[model samples]
Target: MWKVVVVALAGLVLAGVGGVALAYPSLAATTCPGCYGLTELSPGVHVEDGLSPAQRERVGEVADQAARRVTAFYGGRRSSPGLLVCLTEACYRRIGGGQERGVAVLNRSVMLSPRGLDPVIASHEMSHVELHARLASSAEVPQWFDEGLAVVVSGDPRYLAPESAPDRCLVAPSGPLPVTLEEWLRTASADPATYARSACQVSRWLGENGGRAGLLGLVTRLNAGEPFSALVRTR
Candidate 1:
């Protein structure tokens, strides 16, 4: 009877672990890309099984273009993170994606859903990967700065005016901009204009500062142990 009880307890523990893994499949993708049946199409690029050869080729092209764009914006080259493309919604959900067209998994990888296959979206996600890779820890970076910088780097027209100065507010925010990641996520979920607000603020800062040079200088300062608040104080 004791042996049976012990086995039952072990099964329960395993089941709990399995449940969590199922709910958050990104855990497996981040640590073990092979676990989800992804096929490597090229260096740092992986795709789910259902993508055709043509789709695979498209993914590679998009990834390359995104990398080039981000590199150009930074004025320096950084290694590209792993790119995981999911052609089907099932695959996207299996890899823990929801409404987001794409998501950057830490600084290691970016997962692209079917709708996220566009160059702009890919570049946007890659922007996150690039910034995160530059820092020892992203905890020091404000959520608005991170997200807004990604928008600027990607030139996402949805949030900014076309061919206009970065400081121009394309979409007005419904409320105050968020600072912390938690607050950013909450506001983003509730208000679609959060990205616009963030982009506007960062753009305004860039305009007042030295634009691209200023951004590079800020990153250099952050990397050299300067506090973000001190580097990015209100003028």
Candidate 2:
């Protein structure tokens, strides 16, 4: 069985499987072979593919719904217009499968397994793509923040709890508040509970503080090299 290999970055960790060495650029480049969308999102990221016509339509529906949610959440920001959706098992395998899903922001893409997710759940994964693109590429939003927002945006309340937290989100407490970003990335994996709580907190904070507009500001601040400590402090 293939295992997960996680790559860490500015407090975010992406899960990959096997020694397959799926180059990020190649995997990111896996658009519809010959088709690429030329919009603000440019070369819209491929989600999953290799499905029957019905499945393809379903994937497209899921993608469209997710796009709406992202736009609603960050209407003020410039988001990629479309997301290439795929649903074939083979397509999942080509990218990797140990992890439930993967999102590549550089190429403005997202990939997921549609085995058991409902449209809402799949939309959640799509939200991750939007978040990845909207947030400052260099911001230290923290893994919990990233995964948490994805879950919250999906509209699933379960993700607000630790036990129900996503597999990749990890967190630990060094003192009293919660595990710092440094601790989260340094740890082997995030603690499920801490991650959930942090995500919920951030989501609520963004909503109450400035709604989507505030969230955009936070992401912009992070991308501009503002201290996460200052930005996240509101949360």
Candidate 3:
């Protein structure tokens, strides 16, 4: 089965949406070929999918939380709903979606194939959406911050069985070693289980020292072109 995975930025493949490479401008709602069904959640925010009621509700909750989180981070909320979740690959295909596992347009919704939509996975992917939006533009986010925070927001902070988490969240090859920021940026994608653990490890470190705010600060600084060596020591 086809599952989305993160590709290098140079390729324009969405990080989580199934891996079909496309130019960033092509991801807009009107332009997107795969427009699934749409359901308004809050005032402007709506989720687009063909999921059952229960599943739809799950999408709404995550989208709501993502909106709130982004507003808190960037000091403003989306006037128009900036969230989208697709359940079936058909929905993704309608938008001319790529093979990348998922894609988040900073300041907009996220698009992913419906083949794997667990509660944790949904939250995790939406966090990427929130991060993307809060940054106001995609260029502001780094892969480490984008992926790590996705792992943190996916659910209550705790580990689960391998079968329970998304496959891509699993640990990467270098996971046995003490992972550093450098390693996080350099490493390729992993299964959900490994991704979750890696996020946890980074989240744990952030919490032990600086909490989410601290982590955000560190990320922001790095994104501004500060060296990891400097931010890592300060954080």
Best by TM-score: 1
Give each model a TM-score.
Answer: 0.84, 0.62, 0.55
Clashes of 1: 0
How many residue pairs clash per model? 0, 11, 42
TM-score of 1: 0.84
Ten contiguous residues minimizing lDDT sum, candidate 2: 33-42
**Model 3, 1-235: lDDT tens per residue?**
1233333453454443434333342254523433335555555444564557897777667556655654554355333424455666666666545665555544345555564344455455556655544443323433554566566555434432232454333343243422454655345343334455555555555556566677567657656777655555312
Clashes of 3: 42
Q: What is the C-alpha local distance difference test score of candidate 2?
A: 0.52
In the range 1-235, model 1's lDDT, one tens digit per residue, is: 9999999999999898688678778866866667787888888888997677798889989888888889888887565788888889998888888889998886678999999998889888888888877776643688888998889888888998764563477865444567898998998899878898888778778887888899878888888888888888542
Candidate 2 deviant stretches above 4 angstroms: 1-50, 81-86, 105-107, 136-138, 161-191
Q: What does candidate 2's lDDT look like per residue over 1-235, in tens digits? A: 1223232442243334212244543243343323222112224534443445676556556666766765666663355533444355555555444345444334355555546235555556566666766665576666656666766666555545343444322332333333455765444255446545655566656656676778777777778899877767532
